[model samples]
Target: MGDTGMPRAFIPRPSPCAPPSPISVFATIDSPPWTLAMSTYGYENCVAGTFYGFTKTEFNPGDTFSLQWGAIDDGATPLNITLGRAGGYIIDEIIVGAQFTKTSALYQLVVDDTANCTLEEFSWAIPDDFNTTDPQYQIGLFNASVLLGADGVPLFGWQAWNPDFYVRPVSSTTTTDASSTTSTVAATATGGNTTTTTSATSLSTFSASPTSSSVSDDSTSNSETIGIGVGVGVGVAALAAVLLGAFYLRRRRKKAQTPSQGLGGVRQQYIQELPATEKRPPMHELAG
Candidate 1:
């Protein structure tokens, strides 16, 4: 995709009454259609919505980025599966990560393990034909894929579509003339926890840590820039220990609720989108 602007993402936040906790960009592991979540103040259950968590709000077509999350499957294992179909949709553009796999018109990613709840990340490349100029045309994943199947066909509750995502408007005089685009994104801090550094590069920068997400057209390579602050010190021992205790405490809240039946027995998920306009999100205090 040509330079439209930096890709943007959005996500949900914890309640104000919640305590200071490690923040993470994660997808919930539940029934077929899972939800994306992030924790800032404290731990909470997933909230279904028109838009889930994202570091940026709008992503430029061809912009490659990652979606990482920690989810526990108290309901059933989230297996990544794709149906034999004709063409590709927005969700099909996924390059596939971890449990993720894709065909021409279909893809599936189950970042969450069958049980362990830590972090798993993957990179996604938006196709050039994608809609970036219109929010109505903005693609949605997870909760909003009700009316879509592989290749945008009619499916009940699979990774069919996306929402609240957009493409940035290119400054006509600027984008075409420049060989590379340099843009600075301002960060919005909530509860004084999330902090993001504003930077820019020629290609476009996308990275994820335990804490927050920052996008800059600022890095030379997208893969090289990921996990920038994710230190090596978070050894398996530490993560395993923390997850053990955190798992039990969080597992009690793991019951799943099927989305109410829509017309023709299709599972339709009604959602209330939480504000994710804030730029970077912090990992849990323990994540540090």
Candidate 2:
């Protein structure tokens, strides 16, 4: 396919062991198709600051892949290839030729004859953290001269404005124990009498993962419910019995508190003792 605009310029790192460019992480996305075009030697139709022949876009963590440069026409000289976050490199800063070949102590790649070259594959052990948060990755092709501290060298690498590939998002279900253990050594000595005390506290805090409920769990729950219900019923029955006993005792006490009727009364007792036919004499007859 024709070039989809020009690739961006990439600045060479100061040192060989320089870190990949600091890139803000983004969610994983599907990769786009490769659009690098290349030509043969002498009349090499190669463009400056642009990588030519890489195809695959997305890769799984720890997978290996090959990076292709169409044709350099620079035979037997080593090249510098780097992978990092894209959109931040300058292309014109990389200089190629015999003087720049294999200048750095670091090794990027070796090409015996660029004109009759075969693309060699490279493997990147993608780290565990290269997931949903940070997916963008890119590669660059450069000459070893980019590493030297020349007085007036303004060359850059051939790279793209966007990332070349991505790492697929991995589900984060199996996170490791986030807690670290620490040991504090203690010693107590009293005239050669020594003791060691270990008061280590371990705290394991993680989300309570849901587990499949078994029959025993259901049975325990049901048993607890049944026991509570039976206890409440027994408590209510005991309360009722206590209230009935109190009511009966109160009635007996009330009856005992009442005075005896007519037995302790003198007129009523005399009238009851006299016969029913007996009558009292008149006052005049009594006087005569």
Q: Please give each candidate's TM-score.
A: 0.27, 0.40
Error of 1 at 111 (Å): 9.5
Q: lDDT per residue, candidate 1, 22-46, as tens digits? A: 2212222322323222222221343
Q: Please provide, for model 2 over 1-288, each residue's C-alpha lDDT reduced to its tens digit, 9 standing for 90 to 100.
A: 223234444343545565333121222112222211122334233443334345567666655444434334332333455445655333232112311122321112323345444222223345455444666766655455335323333334332332367766544321221221122122222232333222222111212222334556888999999999999999999999999999999999888766565346866778799877867875665564
The per-residue C-alpha lDDT of model 1 at residue 136 equals: 30
Q: What is the lDDT of candidate 2?
A: 0.43
Residue 1, candidate 1: Cα error in Å is 36
Q: Indicate the worst ten consecutive residues by lDDT in candidate 1.
A: 96-105
Off by over 4 Å in 2: 1-12, 15-56, 74-77, 86-117, 147-155, 159-163, 172-288
* Candidate achieving the largest TM-score: 2
